[model samples]
Target: MKPIVTIAETTQPDGTVLALQEHDGRRFLLSDNVQIASPATKVSERELARIACAPFRPIRQPRIWVTGLALGELLEGLAESVPQKRATFYVAEPSDELADWHREFYPEGTFATDKRVFRVHGVDTGALNSLDSPLHGILLHADTAPLHPRGRGFFEDRRWLSVAYDTLQEGGLLAVASSRRVPKMDRNLENAGFEVAYHEIDAIPNARRPKTHHLWLARKGDYTSHAH
Candidate 1:
């Protein structure tokens, strides 16, 4: 086995050291304290994203907010899963190193050549605050679980959840893919006023292990925010 190579490192304001590691054709981005945000070998994470975006009934030219564009698996899944041909993806990824890896590794694939993806780089949920219009769906696959610190207090702060709640068009969907299921995560989404559903998938595709991957689906509301 080849040793893990550190590609890029970022220091959080809290003095946390986050490093991106490459090994066996996969990239792992995480803080020194926890392991999360790996798109290369985290096949289960991709599965989680796919599961989160279920029963898709997107309106015309539906706009999707993808908080994490890890290797563009979710984007690929979304672009393939949705019936609509016209769609736009707002990709919020704070790591420049990761984006570079995406480009170098998958130039003509999911992230690079996809005409629909728009990348946003920020330390936190900077992209979520500014909304030109109500969105049809929002998919979050940040460094870790929703309660993790990678989002710059996105899940830690209730106001951010409210922003998500308000930004969605009625019947819109919000999905999150996480390595582990945090305590009270479902309750927190409920507090944010979303009808949430939970799913557990394999941590790695075709690998034998307990179902550890977590996927949460939250619908905005029953009626369309726009005219029916």
Candidate 2:
């Protein structure tokens, strides 16, 4: 059974009057001062799944890196999209509580017990520099600020793009979802030596009304442009 949730107006430490919500007895972090009663129907997981699996459709199977394993919803979607027996999956989460919650409440046939999957390094996504693996795809769902920022210099750091570039193999794809539209995100990926593509995806149901997300797909080395 789904848990009951409550919404309240609150202020952040930065003095932003954002809407706060609690779901399944846990508080969720959201942007745009918006709130919802249940997390079971949020845009986050849909955004993650679209960004993670949309690029490599023709490939027989692809190895994927899923950063920010919040609630394991993204991982579960990814497992369903890709052939579990043929694909390799890695999920990185920074919070133990989130991982534990996923293990307890999520569906029974989710990505939890898959042998081809590996869960590791519950640290910040920024520390992904140490990750050594040949990846066909990388999905960044932790924070969009590294791609688009309301604050200066928050997304301009080159190391994040560099790490993303270094992690992908030639013809590999990297997709990130931004809360707001960011033209600079395209330029940043290009500056990092990737041919970038951009798309806008519909937000999940019942969380925020008429909200859409910006998705950026950048490819390392050479690839045909699909997003003109």
Candidate 3:
């Protein structure tokens, strides 16, 4: 068996170690010794993009916000799923080193040089409010979201979900995926004004035996105010 070799590494502001590594000619990323992304798991990322952009394909200038840049698979998935030339992708990644790793080690990666992608500071309310136009979709994955302080709140906090709701155009989608089911996720999204639809997809499409992943496609609905 081939051993995994570290190609490069960087320390985040919070002192966690992030590394780019390769094993048997395949590249992947690790955060604090835990694997976050690899070519082997790209099927789930592509599925995330496909489900998020499928409805908005007819819209010529759809704007999408993607949380995290791990190995650029989400952006690559978006490029393949959304063919509109005018579509834009806003990537929210708090770690400068992660972006740098993409550029330095994987220059050919889609998000590394894609003109349609604009890097944002984070996915907090302030960042969401700064957008000039409401987004058509927002793609999120539990393992790929930012690791900065308060970053995880975007997944569970009603207040933050409300901000996301307000940031989207009517009927826009917020697609979130996780390796395992999250209790009360549907209620949390509903509390934020989304019409939630749950789906289970093959994480590793087409294997002798397949494992399913949990995905929630929450679409924004009619105008309403909900207490946070």
Candidate 4:
């Protein structure tokens, strides 16, 4: 068998190491020692996207933003859930090389190909601003949970959460996935003015795994003071 090859590597400002590795024909994007994305996590990860995209099904040509491009499983799942030719997904991936690795290893394009996504390269997804049309849904399933060395505080930072809230259309959805439950993040989400629902998922459903996952699905209320 071939060794797991490191396709690209970069050190974050905080001295965190980000590497894209390939093993057994599968690519793994790692934030230090933690597993960010890989084939092993695909099923459960897709399940996360599935749960997030379900409520927004009635929206026509719903626009969605996915913060990370670690693996395209989330996008794949979003594709399955929305299944609309006109649905547009804006994928904000901070690392261009990592995105390249994804294209090289998993094939370029988002959600099965290039049909579903408008890939945003080299942008800090955390600082994303509102769009011309508010997003119908936003899925944040990046490398690590908030406060982790590699998380970049996607959920922990109130600024980011605020931006996420304002970036969404009324009644839009925001879903966050993490390896474990975060009480603080839950509170932060609430403070950011979302009516949140939390769900726990097996990392690999129907298959035993020591790791569990937490998917927080929050909806932006159409009215009644949840606005930022």
> Top TM-score: which candidate number?
3
> What are the TM-scores, per candidate, against the unseen true structure?
0.78, 0.68, 0.92, 0.82
Cα misplacement distance, residue 224 of candidate 1 (Å): 8.0
lDDT of 2 by residue, 89-198 (tens): 87764444445555655536354577767766542335555567567877765342211224432235576667767777787777776556766788888899888877
Candidate 2's C-alpha runs over 4 A off are: 1-44, 58-61, 107-111, 122-129, 142-156, 204-209, 223-228
Q: Please give the TM-score that candidate 4 achieves against the real structure.
A: 0.82
- Alpha-carbon RMSD to native, per candidate: 3.5, 6.5, 3.7, 3.8
Give the candidate order by descending TM-score: 3, 4, 1, 2
Query: lDDT for every model?
Result: 0.67, 0.59, 0.83, 0.72
For candidate 3, list the clashing residue pairs, or say none. none
lDDT of 1 at 78: 70
- Overall local distance difference test of candidate 2: 0.59
Q: What is the lDDT of residue 153 in candidate 4?
A: 53
- Evaluation by TM-score, superior candidate among 2 and 4: 4
Rank the candidate models, highest lDDT first: 3, 4, 1, 2
The TM-score obtained by model 2 is: 0.68
| Model 1 pairs in collision | 170-225
Per the 3 Å backbone cut-off, how many clashing residue pairs does candidate 1 have? 1
